[model samples]
Each structure stands twice: as structure tokens, then as C-alpha cells.
Target: MKTKFFSLLVACLIVTSVFSQANLNDYKYVIVPTKYDFLKESNQYQLNALTQFLFNKYGFETLMEGDEYPEDLVRNRCLALRSNVTKDAGLFKTKLLITLKGCNDQVVFTSQLGESREKEYNKAYTEAIRNAFKSFEAVNYKYEPKAKDVMVATENTEVKNEVAKEIKKLKEEIQALKEEKKAEVIEVEETVVEVVKKAPVVKVQTKEVKNTKEKVDMKASTSVLYAQEIENGFQLVDSSPKVIYKIKKTSMKDVFLVISKNGTLSKKGSDWILEYYENDVLKQEVLNIKF
Candidate 1:
């Protein structure tokens, strides 16, 4: 009877473990911090990089903190788990443990304690982190977004399609207007030519040149902007600490609607580009933004 009960308990435990691992598949991304709490600076000894690599190797899509997130993840942060590493006090050895938390700050999973006896900080941390990742290897994480996430994605897709259709319709109307205006201008020019041909021609010559320079407005573009997080977005300030532009968050990732400038700020490659209309002319400026 005792043997049978023990076997049943073991089976229940195995089932529970499997269930927990399967739940992890609901998360689409693992966000690793650039710096661990135990370390002095960011990515010290390349430990964070190794952590990211290991997560990727175990079939988990990993991203470093502060990296531009996918639009879905930005809209619904709960789809991604935040990773943290903690170091335990050890006299003769280095020990590390990895913890993953949800967007609500709930602990989702914790790795087994990883230990190394190496004296060097780099080697010790690397070995300890790798050892701790054995748990992840066993689980073999693969992203399988939940039903709710899939529904949300579908809704977003529908909205984007509607918006695209409206934009296309507007473009077609503008093109038709331009064609009509071009035809009207040609007719007017032809009338002017007929009048000139019917009238006598007279030419006037002058040696003196008249000044035709027009006043132009110059904007300073050398000031570096500092981003300060606000309620829905951020306010950019210059070195003098004066607010330059207030940008609001958009549904798209790495794209913000500039409230102050009536423009859009978007990330293109490694640069942040600001585009707005000034004096009926569209202008694009590369912003030196420190976030």
C-alpha cells in the first residue's frame, strides 16, 4: 500500500511540472535586463549577453532591456516575461539563480541554484549562469501565444486594414484633383499665348540688377534632446533644460506622435527621425535623442 501511494504522488508531481512548463509557452518573449542586480554596471563580464544567448538557444525569443519591442508586446506587455539574475553569498564559490516575472511583477519561474568554484569573476559568473539554465534546457521553451493574444492580434490586423484602405482612398482623390488642376493650368497658359500673339511685342533691357532675395527662417538643429518619460509618452528637453517637444505614444512600435511639433518621431535603423511640415514644406530632421 505504501509503495503504491508513493508512485501515485510521484506521478502527480510529474504532471504538475509538465503543466507549469506548458504554461510558459504562452509567453512570446523573455526580456533580459542589461545589468544584473548583483553586478556593478550593465553587461559586466558579458554575463547578460550570455543569458540572452542561452534563452535563445532554449527556443525562447529573447530581447535585451531597452531594445525596441514588437508592436504586440508594446501594446500588451503581459505577453513578455522579465528576466532577473540574483547572486547568493558564497565564501569559496559563486552561485547564481535566474528568476522570471510577469508584467504584474509576479514570480513565474525560478531556476535551480547554479554554482562555480572559479576565482575569476567572469568565468565564475558564466559557469554559474550556464548551470542555472539547465532547468530551461529541460523544459525546452517554445512560444505559443494564448488564445486571447491571438484574438487581440486579429483585431489589430483588422483595424490596420481599415486604416490602410482609407489612406489609399484619400491618395486616389488627391491624384484626381492634381490631374484636374494640371489640365486647368495648361488651358490658362494657352489663352495667355494667344493674347500675346495677337498683341505687339515690346522688349525692355536694363543693366541694373534688382535684389530678389527672400527672408528665410533658420531653425537650430544642433541641440541634443533628452527624453523625459511622462504619463503617456515623453517630453524632450535641450541642454538648457527647456522642453522642446512633447511626444505622445502611438499604437505602433518605435513611433510617436509629436504633440509640440505636429509631426511624427520614428526610429529608422539606429537614428530617430522627426518629420513635420514647416511653411508648407515637409522637413525631416535627424534627432540626437538620449533616452
Candidate 2:
């Protein structure tokens, strides 16, 4: 009789322990909130309660809310997330999401299966959540101070003075560091200017811009003068010294030569704009102007 009683007690303890270490994979989502703990706002029918309480009860770790599981309730399992979605211009709607199986690797479960008896499903799911929380707590996160508690040290005037002296020494050292930085900055600026002066100046030939009237209605009432360039074979030449243009109507028909103040023919040039429109009738000439 004694042996039988001992075996029975051991079996009960084992069952309790097994339930306490329940994982999310071994359960299904509750389709409805159980009316078991109504007065407690924290025990709402949402996933938060399911996750939080389970985390609290079972000490579950490595499970994040809204993650590692689908958060939306299934369509058949869906209760309106929004009490009145029309109110506040559609702002008060709770997003209907499904809670997926955790660590089970199967996220999709039939919503119809859960809807048949949501209360029972929720009861089992809640139990699993509670177990998960228990597992989380089994591995607690508590910190112990590495240093001795400050209160244990008796107050002393000499110790206070020593700390104050060290602080004053640190301030003096900081002030010295600042002075050194200021001197270094001045030295760097002088060195930069000296380097610039020592560098050789290489002058590059600048190119001129050519302005031509667009054939369509996008033509703006603006005139531009640019430099004319001449290239040796395929090499590019940019030598812009002046440019000028006017919006007034001219008598050149469809051909307008942009005459530069330096007398370069705008229409007959091997330049960027003139060369591109070799077969086109020149509508306007961009002249270059120099001060």
C-alpha cells in the first residue's frame, strides 16, 4: 500500500511538471476569449493576454509577441477588432490577424476547425500559454551588483575629500587637453595653406555654350550667348568667353545665326549645339558677351 501511494504521488508530480513546461507548438489558438477572468483587463481575449500570462505563469522565453506566430485571428475565428470602425473615420478598428503555431513550422490551420468550439480551443491554448510563461520564468533574469553596496561603507570626511581631490585633478587634466587641441588646430590650418601655395596651377581651356531655339511650343522667351569650340578630329574643345540671346522676332526666316560679340558665326560652327543640328534650320543665334 505504501509503495502504491508513493508511485501515485510521483505520477501526479510528473504530470504537473509536464504541463508546466508546455510549448506553443503543442497547442492551438483560442478562437474566443474565455469569460473565466472578466474583471481583469489584462486577461482580455487578445494575444497579449495569451502571451503575457503564459509568459508570467510558465516563464517562457525566446517567444516574442506578434512574432514567431501570425498575430491575426482567422476569418472564422475573427471577432471585430474594431468596436466601431466607422467611428473616428475608420481609426478604431482592431486588425484581424491569425496566431500561427510556434516552433511547429505549420502556420496555417483551418479556421473552421477552431470556430466549431472556440471556448474549448481557447482553454487549451490558454493552458499552453500559461505553460510557456512558466518555462520563461524557469530561466529568470535577475542581476546582482558586482560591487559592494554603497550603504555599507561608513561615511567619512577624509574619503569625501579624497574623491573631491581626484575630481579636481581630472578637471585640470581636461583643461590641459583642450589647450593642446587648440594649438594643434592652429598648426594644421597653417600647414594646409602652405600646401595649397606649393601646388602648381594648371590652366585648362574652357568651352563655349551655344543656344538654339527649340522648334516646338516649349521655346522660352530667353536668349543665351556661349563660347564657340573647335576640335582637332574627335578631340573636344571647350573655349567659352561670351554668350548672348534675344527673344525678339527676327527676319532670318527659319535660319538665324547667333553672332558673338567676337564675330563667331553661331549657325556655322563645329560646336556642341551647332554640330548636333547640322541638318536643321537655325532658328536663333546665341551670341557671347564679355564685360
Candidate 3:
């Protein structure tokens, strides 16, 4: 009697897994939020970006929260699932889990708990997220939208065209804002130069900036570093998955303040260079960075 009961439990587990996989495969895309409720800032420690990256890596089509949605997804929200990462209280560990919900706000799937004991916030979050994603290894997800969604797509050609037009308009607006920001940066630089000329103390600071720029290496580094978005600006990481530098945005375009280091990170042509003072001499190292 005990053996028979064990067999029945195994059968039930298999059936539940199959059902969950079927529901997951019916959705074509997943949307990851720009920020998680447990975090104070958008993409803090690059957790949100890491979430999207892991989903795409695990055979799911993932989109950022504010990204333009496909026409069918816009028309029938049920065609996509919403993704969320939740934190669990732990005394000495960072614990997290991934949840996927349907259009009706019903939870469709939840990943196993992922925990990390790393003391650093960034490392802890990264490890916990990757651990949570391990649950998807067996899913083998491939979108097989239901027949009803396919039929709606076939019948909504006009609506698709309108969505396309709206997407185009959004792109134009984004470009305009970028250009406006560049203009403001240039104006700020001009004002700074005027102040330097009028004040003796300011003039000395201007010379320091000039010397830093002059020390920059024109040749770019052959090795590349990846830039991960953080709260203010970005953190550059090496291939070893180590943080090389954390930079904050400056008013000037393509220039960043290297935190804790008396230096600046700036773009020269297509290459990024780090200029810092070691002892009394200024040193420059060109960096190949991917954002």
C-alpha cells in the first residue's frame, strides 16, 4: 500500500510540471519591470537588467517594461506574461524568486527560491538571481501561441499599422530629447569656461581638467569591459565578472566621475579612457567598453 501511494505521488508531480510547461509555452513574450518593489532605485545593482538577460538566455523573448510592444501583444495582452522578482526575508542570506503572471493578474509560475550569502549587495543580488533562473533549465520553453491569438493577429492588420506608426513617432521623440541634452551640455561647458576666466581659483581647476584630457591615451585598449547600468550611471566589469570601476554621470556628454578615484572617465573618439593621478603624475589608460 505504501509503494502504491509513492507511485501516485510521482505521477501527480509529473502531471503538474507538464501543465505548467504548457501554460508557459502559450505565451510569446515576457515583460520585465524596470524596478523591483524591494529595491529603492530602478535597476539598482543592475538586478533588473540581469533579470531580462537571464530570461532571454533561457529561451524566452523578454522585453523591458517601457519598451514598445508588438501589435498583437498590445491588442491582446494575454499573449504575454509579466515577470517579477520578489525578495524573501533572511537573516544572513539574500533570497529571491521569479514570478510570472498572466494578463488576469493570476500567478502562472514561480521559480524555486534562490539564496546567496555574499556580503556585498551587488554580488548577493547577482548570485541570487542566477540561482533562481536555474529552475528554468528543464522548461525548454518555445512559444506556441494559442489558435485564438493567431486568428486575432490575422484579422488586425489595421491595428498593427497604427502601432507601427506610434512606434516610429516614439523613436523620433527620443532622438529629439537626446539632441536637446547635447545642446545643454555644450552650453554648460561654455559657461564653465567663462567662470574660469573670471576667477583665479577657477582658472587653476580648468588647467587641471585640461592636463587630464591631454594625458589621455589616443590608442584604445584591446581588452573590453562591459558596462552595466547602476542607479546613477554605470559599473564597468571585466570578463572575470569583477567590478573594475563605478562611474557617475557628469554634466558634460561622454564624461563621468570615477567614484573613490581621483580621475575621470571620458570618451575620446570611439574609445573610452580613464585619467587618474598616481603619486604626482597623471596617467591615462584607454579602455574598450561595451554598454
lDDT scores in order: 0.83, 0.34, 0.85
| Per-model TM-score on C-alpha atoms | 0.64, 0.22, 0.53
Residue-wise C-alpha lDDT for candidate 2, range 1-291, written one tens digit per residue: 999999999999666544433433233232223322322453444545454444334322322323333332231122111110000111322112223333334432211111111244345444434333333333333222112222322334457789999999999999999999999977865664464334221111011122343341112223433333332111112244232332211233222222322111223353212211223332223333221
Highest lDDT against the true fold, candidate: 3
Candidate with the greatest TM-score versus the true structure: 1
Q: lDDT by residue for model 3 over 169-207, one digit each (tens)?
A: 999999999999999988876775464335333244357
Candidate 1, position 289, lDDT: 94
lDDT of 1: 0.83
Question: Can you tell me which runs of candidate 3 are displaced by over 4 Å?
Answer: 1-6, 157-291
lDDT of 1 by residue, 1-291 (tens): 999999999999778668768878888899999998888999999999999999999988999999999999999999899999999999999999999998899888888999999999999999999999998766867788788888989999999999999999999999999999999977866764465344221111011111323232324367789999998789999989999999876655887778877767789898898876566444567888999
Question: What's the best-to-worst order under TM-score?
Answer: 1, 3, 2
Q: Rank the candidates by lDDT, best first.
A: 3, 1, 2
The weakest ten consecutive residues by lDDT in model 3 span 196-205
Clashes found in each candidate (C-alpha, N, C closer than 3 A): 0, 39, 0
Q: What does each candidate score in C-alpha RMSD?
A: 23.0, 22.1, 28.5
Give the residue spans of candidate 1 off by over 4 A: 1-13, 198-291
